[model samples]
Target: QQTPASYYFTEKKAAETRIQPRQKFSHKGTFGHALLVAGSFGKMGAAVLSGKACLRSGAGLLTMHVPACGYEIMQISLPEAMTTVDKHEKINTQLPELDAYSAVGIGPGIGKEQPTVELVEKLLDTIGVPLLIDADALNILSENRQLLDKLPAKTILTPHPKEFQRLAGDSSNEFERLEAGRQFAIRHQVIICLKGANTAVILSNGDVHFNSTGNAGMATGGTGDVLSGIITSLLAQKYPAEDAAILGVYEHGLAGDRAAARRGQSALIASDVVEYLGW
Candidate 1:
């Protein structure tokens, strides 16, 4: 019989099992470039936060694609990351070269514009690398349920309970929701990082790893974007899909724990979580 101890994933274990050490011969290009397609008009902060977190998590380079209106803001706010501007000033209509990036993360603060639907569809059809889907991107998937089938093998999906409900339909409780998540991962051959307390990382093999870090302090806006960045960064660093999800989720929550300790829950913000990603 399965016991609680059998399922628990603790911080100490996660730290010991984190990404491998960097080699002395490694260069900037060795880590791979990560592309983040995100932001809208007033939500440019989302793009900035995700980009910062991605770099902080060990992505060698980052290119953040945003609407033209956000170009200056992204450049000014995150000088470390390069920027690509979409044709439209407030929405993303043009898609960049999918082959250019080692990994792609999309949907933080992106509004559900009609053109974005087509862009997401085109990405799923064309992208050959691992993809991380979250926030508005998940909503777009719900609207076009058919697109779920086009997801690249081993795609990573980060969703809260409400977002999961939209994709998989309503659930009576957390138990039912998790069962659905496990089935969803198995059916689609993808990883599901179901964000919340414990943040269940459901693998395609029907295994669910519960993160034992993080705190109520992380229950605020923009934190999910940070999580997305961390996972995307891990993918860029070439961690396998299942390992990336499990390790990224654990580290993200562990950062939150550190943030809470330093700032207290009330004062902890998403940027603090990014700052505390020393592991």
Candidate 2:
């Protein structure tokens, strides 16, 4: 079936209008705190990338909850963000108190260990603020389908094609996949950023907004983590879920586009994308 053109939007001017300008009188607290639960023993880079992007994208205060193995790495890689070490030395096994955070983003490099799965479940049940789920967290949801109903309304899930396929089941083609995403978002009452060229931001109301920036070079690893951080930052700042997803996706891709221009598509890395985040 053909989707209506009216249902599709390109987030250029719309994203610009939604970006909140900082006021001189506004202090760090005014921007809101963001908590990121990420990383594992060998994949601490994911935590670093996400944490750095979170701070760079305007999160006033950012905290990374990582396993002991990642604590020092996160501290040195992202000194601007605070760190909370998990009890488990290799993987995340504890849920930090969420009351202080304005928003949370989870599932970067955290492996699919049983303890981490339990932690994810615990967070889902207890968290009252805006949430963003990505990477391994999305994989956990795929493995434990029952948890889908536990998702808070308007929670954002950023999934590349494979992760989305795992969550929503396989589609014969991209069109089928997009429709599946729309249905999934509507049924779950969550926002889905189906990552790809012109990545589609599917809202709970079934609206689809395609991103206007980005390049194929962004296919590198850790880029999705960067996007999760960016969106989480916006969510922390109190952007409506719809606006956060739309603008975050746009800004993430715009950064990728800028990085590609400087480093050439083949040389661009996720950190380069972070360095180019202009707004």
Candidate 3:
């Protein structure tokens, strides 16, 4: 049985790895650069929210690429993060080079437009680092099932039940849900994070780990977007895919807990969760 504690990550130590303490002089690049491709014409807030939360999560640098329409809004809302515009203003098609980014995050407010489908497929095929797919990007993948195996190794997929059903087919119960996630992860050589109460982190080794944090209050808009940002930021910092997902869920939910304390879950908005990210 996969217990909640199964989500605990084992620390990895390497001799060749540089161990810089907090007191040491580390540069911004010491963290990492995260490429976040999100948002569309009407869904600018999604991009802004994810970018802000990622920057807050301590990503060394964040570059958000959105539709041309969201370019100005993103730049204006997030001064700390960089912005780039694609050929289309709405992310109709085409993504930039995958090799240029340390980690990649897609989905979030991205609509399921047919052209965007082609772009998502291309990114799945070409991205060479840890990849995170959320929101409509998962929807796109469901439509393009053939591209599932093309995802890069150690990719982290953040999907709610609906999105999980699309990628992993269907599951009648939590046990079946886990089984599907397990098979999918092993088959694709990626991580599948099925988000819910006791969120499951399916690993490439066929182990199913479940998170203990989070509450029902987190079931709101932009909350999942925040999770995607946190996981992507952790991945940018070189954490393993499963580690990033587990820690990200814990931290993201912890942030939500803090926000709920202040405003109560009834009043809690997604922005409140991001506001409490300092926790």
Best by lDDT: 2
Top-scoring candidate (TM-score): 2
Residue 227 CA displacement from its true place in model 2, Å: 0.3
Ranking by TM-score: 2, 1, 3
Across 27-78, the per-residue lDDT of candidate 2 in tens digits comes to 9999999999999988999999999899988989999999998878988989
Candidate 1 residues lying further than 4 Å off, grouped into runs, are 1-10
Each model's lDDT: 0.89, 0.92, 0.80
Where model 2 places Cα greater than 4 Å from the true spot, the runs are: 1-6
Q: Give the per-residue lDDT of model 3 (tens digit) for 190-214.
A: 8888888777778877776666666
TM-scores of the models, in the given order?
0.96, 0.97, 0.90
**What is the per-residue lDDT of model 1 for residues 1-279, given as tens digits with 9 covering 90 to 100?**
121212446567665576678899999898989999999999988898899999998989999999999988998999999999999989888889777789999989998989999999999988989899999999999999999999877899999989999999998999888888888888898989988999998887778788889999999999999998998998988888888888888889989999999989999999999999967
Ten contiguous residues minimizing lDDT sum, candidate 2: 1-10
Clashing pairs in 2: none
The TM-score of predicted model 3 comes to 0.90
What is the Cα-based lDDT of residue 77 in candidate 2?
A: 87
